[model samples]
Target chain A: MTASPDQIVVRDALKTYGTGAAEVTALAHVDLTVDRGQFVSIIGPSGCGKSTLLRLVAGLETADSGDVTVFGADPDQACAAKMIGFVPQVPALLPWLSVEGNVTLPSKVNRRADALRRTLPGHVHREPADPRALLTKIGLGDSLARLPHQLSGGMQQRVAIARAFAIQADVLLMDEPFSALDEFTREAIQVQLLELWEQMRTTVVFVTHSVSEAVVLSDKVVVMSARPGRIDAVIDIDLPRPRRQGLLESAAVHDYEDLIRGRLQTAWAAGPATR
Target chain B: MTDTTDTDQTGAAPTGATPTGAAVADTALATAATAAAASVRRRQPSRSLLRPTIWLPAVGALIVAGVLWEIVAINNTYLLPRLGMIGQAIVTQPSFYLENAGVTLSEALVGLVIGFVAAVLVAVLVTESGILRRAIMPLAVVLNVTPVVAIAPALVVAFGFGPAPKLIVTALITFFPILMNVITGLNSVSPPILQVFATLRASRFEVLTRLRLPSSLTFVFAALKVVFPLSIVGAVVAEFSAPGAAKGLGTVISVASSNSRLAVVYAAILCLAIMGSVLLFLVTLLEKRVLRWHESQRLLRG
Candidate 1:
């Protein structure tokens, strides 16, 4: 019953915004752990602290009371080691930098992390992906010299994806990365994301509001409830490998969707009635 | 619904089309127009200077203003010198005008460079330290509000009637705007992008170089546009306060007007105007090169 060496463990983490009178709890007594290389999605209503959870894991926010650890180290330590790559909901590319420049930014800034990675034991030896090649693979080769403002929302998001992948991080924290796209574009990107994830086997903690999206991509769907946010349920998705659009139309997929949807409804009802 | 579809198919491309069909057609039309416009834009080889809307109106306006000035001068020679008279004055002793203009331009250029570097350094410091920003910004505002004219005489007395006082004046006039604009531009990076940098464990220096400094170029250039003219004005004012034989354009104008050499004064003023325009044009050219990817630049192209 030994814990996995590469696991992320969050134990009774609590976060609140503002001083006493204006205080609003973001995450209350939230406890979760994600195994290495697993794709996990957290789905809930708007105030359910999914994003807060992700941020805490990324070391962007600290818990008020509890401990959050990544690979036996604190979140900040893990972040400093370049073990965490965060993709926010927005594309967040530097507007002044060309697409290629933005994608290579992490590699340029993370020299210390590279040295640490080289010394770490049991880490696989791999050459970092070329920024231009990655962009071309994601259909942005021609746009290498273009700035972020010159790109569409979808293309900008793709650049963000390329940037995250280029960081060569162990765990990628994505907070609703596909939420801004149209449905068709979102589906296309989800597939592309899946393919990318499958190729790299990077652990992912994705936050989203879509039930179908959660069921489609995650190895486990973690449902949360609002009003001092906490996890309500964790549903395991036992679908086959290399999941595709065709699998989305199958009855088995519908059953998983129904199960998650039913759990989500209860989680939603359990929250404060006002919301 | 079936009958409507049949009628829609059989009839002349229906005038009042179905929503879906109309939307599809609209999308196609918009895409085609965008592609055509893009192609047309690509075919042109940096023709922004040749565009009628850009330079034509400016040249035409200048000609019209000159003609009106000449007509007004013909009636009132005591106050306004005729264009011909100014031209004659400029032609008679070109060396005097050239030497004076050269002195002013050199002062402005040197002061501008010093002010620009100092402002950028101070902006970086202020942006890095909240305490310093709070402490310095209020004092900057106070200095900014003090009239340059009021300070020119004090500067002249302190630094004497040489180019030193004029250089100080020009630097002082240009520094504030650059500082303000640089701070604003550095702070304007999206929070999400900052988070991205943070997640990568980027050092403060790395963030400044890779993100903030590059992003601030447009704002710095925008500030330069204001500083360019003010630099000239500050240099001129400082020149006006100069004692003997300083020989800047401002000195030329002052001497000419006092001696009732109206045409010489007009000639100096014309030189000043041309210098300001040339400096502005050069700054604009630099801005276009640096901020080629900026949205404002793209909008200008269109």
Candidate 2:
């Protein structure tokens, strides 16, 4: 194992969509590095390219001009190796699959497609720790037999969370996962998220519009500007967990929230394309 | 279910329920009017418990019609052919009707399988590649637009008057809905759900196998429910065109028509209806079994 404290490094990243007259620059010279085990949440308005940034790191999209290295390796290459685990906004569990099958999905997707493929089944598509144990870790032990449709929205997302952990990836990326959920479910999942993070400390880069969510779940919140999305400010959250909504009741949390919203509001108002 | 309806009622209250309830009420009214009309003509299945009641009246009507036919045809044996005469023919020539029915059913089953498989392959290929989608979609539409009647003779000539022509017809007719619905289902992956897969470092194969295929299953099966019967119809019609030469009820019906075996034709027609119903029923069974996880199935199960 490489002894490295920094897992992600993005240098002068540029992302442009379309070409010529129709060309729109989504990201411009975005330079970011996330340290190992750091819980970073990128907060911004819609169209702020926070999702684009995460996608850039996840290898879901390519940067026109930049290098992104995760775990001291190329992000896409590491992802292909099953080095990064992603938990998206809506739980995209296979509907035909039961909860157990959904969680085991990543494991079934072969990591080594060439050379060792025939012999790669055991390590690549693992039936490691019983699904029960993995589900228990994410507060979803009882849902293994249920399908996604049978579960509530929050429950479904939790299963998504369980699947990500089940993959045993070293890094995790979540993008506005709780935005559509109700307040109670969001908070409950947030608490569960912290517990999961504590157990695995996988370098995480979460994107969210909710300032309070960023303040509650993140170690550092990267507030961003609109349109040509860029990091406006980075606020460190030192609140201790097992976290509760009471943390937000504190003046410090509100101050952070206030700071983020103030930055976002100013950024939002100054944009040609409303964020 | 009650809780959900209550929640919806309270949340949306006036507008949403009004429109939805109006639609439901309109459907209910139409069904009621249809049942009433059927009942006036005969007896209808009015009670939910009387599902048998619905068919009973229709059978009674058929029997009444048959008696009238027997009365009318008692004098001229050429037209209706006495009911007793037909019954005698059915009893004595059980093999004739049974054999033709079996042949037709088998042809339908083969065509259904071929069509289903072809549709699924087309759906998967088109979903995966945009160029393939652009290329293959128009071909599918052109096939759909080509009338079965117009193509039946060509198919018979090209494939010979064997099961090949009939199977081709069925496969052609049944391929559209399954392909269309499955494509829609596969592409229906919500952005949020896709984001979850991305975060997990889930491979393309993982996303496709786990998310795309499974999610599209309900849509696929829904298409099958419609297409299976169409396949049966397509196959039978093609066989009818090929008459006496092809192994199907359609051949029997055509031969019977020329021979003036009117009772035999009716028997063949009944068998055709049964075959269509059975194929549709089989698809329904598969849907219920496979998509027990789908929301529609969950609501039904609940």
Q: What is the lDDT of residue B173 in candidate 2?
A: 83
Compose the digit string of candidate 2's lDDT tens values, residues B88-119: 77788888788877877777778878888888
| Per-model TM-score (chain A alone) | 0.94, 0.89
10 residues in a row with least lDDT, candidate 1 chain A: A117-126
Clashing pairs in 2: A85-B199, A85-B200, A86-B199, A86-B200, A88-B195, A88-B196, A90-B192
lDDT of 1 by residue, A95-137 (tens): 7788998899798895788777655432445678788878877
Q: Candidate 2 at residue B60, lDDT?
A: 93
Off by over 4 Å in 1: A1-4, A118-126, B1-39, B42-60
For candidate 1, what is the DockQ-based docking class? acceptable
Question: lDDT at A42 for candidate 2?
Answer: 94
lDDT per residue (tens digit) for residues B1-302 in model 1 = 34333332333122112111222213344234334434544444355447675577889998999999999999998989998999999999999999989999998988998889989998999999999989988988899899988998898888887788999989999999999999999998889999988988999999999889988988999999999998999899888887564579999988888999999998999999999999999999999888877868754443
Candidates in order, TM-scores: namely 0.90, 0.80
Clashes of 2: 7
In TM-score terms, candidate 2 sits at 0.80
Q: Scoring model 1 with DockQ, what do you get?
A: 0.43
Interface root-mean-square deviation for each candidate? 7.3, 9.8
Q: Report lDDT (Cα) of residue B122, candidate 1.
A: 88
